[model samples]
Target: MNVRPTLEEIRRAPKVLLHDHLDGGVRPGTVADLARESGYPDLPTTDADNLREWFEAAADSGSLERYLETFSHTVGVMQSVEALTRVAYECAEDLANDGIVYAEVRYAPEQHLRDGLSLEQVVEAVLDGFERGGREFGIRVGTLVTAMRHQARSMEIAELAVRYRDAGVVGFDIAGAEAGYPPTRHLDAFEYLQRENAHFTIHAGEGFGLPSIWQAIQWCGADRLGHGVRIIDDIKVDGDRARLGRLADYVRDKRIPLEMCPTSNVQTGAAKSIAEHPIGLLRRLSFRVTVNTDNRLMSGTSLSEEFAKLVEVFGYGWDDLQWFTVNAMKSAFAPFTDRLELINGVIKPGFAQLKWSGTRPLA
Candidate 1:
């Protein structure tokens, strides 16, 4: 077994990613190609490198609307079945190259229907791409069908998720603007999923406050909290210690998973800085904290960059990385058998290599 290791070694360990947007991870060059194919102009930059910087700058402006605009160009090109398949395939390939062993890439099928493709067709194409990529690269991939919060078709989307449960679709999710569109607004969808015994996650407490998180868990019955970063609002800290309020206590006592994306949180103004992120505090508190890349292209980050950022800012070691890796495995949408296999066969062996080296396992 691989024993004590350096930080870079730990950071390179095989990872399980529970949060990443399919449209958000498109490479700038891929985006340019998609835009060109669709004859869609208005990209902030034409060159791949410059376009990457442009997306990052626009997202860093702290304007949610501007940050979201980047996806318009991506989704524009992904309207066709061929485009969706290619992007989804490349997403898995890219993650595998980054040392991600298993990843669940989420996307709103409704967004891709602009080209008149049915929701079933959209799901099929993405799942096909994921399967193809996984077989070709030996990377495990899953899909979370996301229903837009601002849209009224959540029930329809929820049904679609259940319909494809046996396929590559692993779970259902509700994402989009979280302000006025509280999880309660999608009560029908949530209730339906609950009745069908389907699992789901909700994007809450990112740009909003405690109420959003509360409704997501207590009202909407979310199995996990996406960007639950704002759950910090309910926490009070003293020096290096912290106290949790009633809601936070429930979340912790229940061992609910929080998908916290440091770089994306900073870009969206959810967290002031990496050092100030609630993830560090939550991790110290023994919360089931898992790191994620909420939006790779927009935030100009990868799972590797995210781990590096945490290591640099928090001085996290191999143990911390292992803890996060296990947390993600425990909270994955995959089946119990698959989850156990990943933890035992993949995560454990990967961590063994890192822990064997004394240097920081993440570089």
Candidate 2:
């Protein structure tokens, strides 16, 4: 007989995160404190608990646009160098405490320039914070500098990513509403990154359909798909048999990583519910499916919480959790040697203990 793993057990599992956002995962209390120090009085509530509830409720409006509105408050407070560094440092500490041994946190450098900070300064501050936090928390953190798809600074952001490639910055990304602002609009950035042999992922297939995903992959050549929940649209299930569309076949055949954020997908209406998410089918089909928390604060989730929910809904066990963790580590933008080191040294060893403990069955 197999027993369900406890929350504490799940929390102790070594995890790898590849799709977290720095601005969207700010601590609620930190938001209030930053707002007060910045003299920004537009917060709905200064009470940390109330603010948290507000963010979750606001993000649950079942519309991606409305869901994104919650970021205004968070991004508003992250203009200065001190605020950016604090948010990044705390992000590392929080994920480390959540048992995430490695994470690649993304944020738009352009969004934090309101206080007249240069793009270089914005990147430097975040890298410094991640360095400090990683040293203190014993967690490895990599930064991905993102560009807003709705805006036209992607090329510039890509340059910044390359400039800091030897630093803490790992990759470039284009993230925003996927409907009107297609990934093709930022071809210059993707082309630039490709020319320089840099890595990049595009936000696609979440709020949009197969076309969005098709363009991101075939057109923009994304290294991974961010919140690619709509990849389900390209897969048709007939009883026990499943058929994949051309795009879906290509995605699966190529083993492109889908950074699926189950809770955040539901909050943004990309997924109807956790039980009905495409990740289950995708995983079973051997797609390169990696679990993530697109926005922890808004979704009120951590990587551990994400795995725990999957366990409850899909009856996942140590083997399943290890699969997703290894997928993420393999798909990470870091060097192949680094990825291999973490997989063998940290992730596998950590899960091996849990596996032999008889907490749950492999299946």
CA lDDT, every prediction?
0.87, 0.93
Q: Highest TM-score, which number?
A: 2
Best by lDDT: 2
Give stretches of model 2 more than 4 Å off: 1-3, 359-363
Q: What is the C-alpha lDDT profile of model 2 across 1-363, one tens digit per residue?
A: 345666789789899999999999999999999999999889999999999999999998889999999999999999999999999999999999999999999999999988899999999999988999999999999999999989889889999999999998999888888888999999988998999999999999999998999999999999999988898888899999999998899998999999999999988889899999999999899999999999999999999999999998998877889999999999999999999999999999998887777645535
Error of 1 at 227 (Å): 0.7
Worst 10 residues of 2 by lDDT: 354-363
State, as a TM-score between 0 and 1, how close model 1 is to the true structure: 0.95
Task: Tell me the deviation in Å of residue 242 in model 2.
Answer: 0.5
| C-alpha TM-score for every candidate | 0.95, 0.98
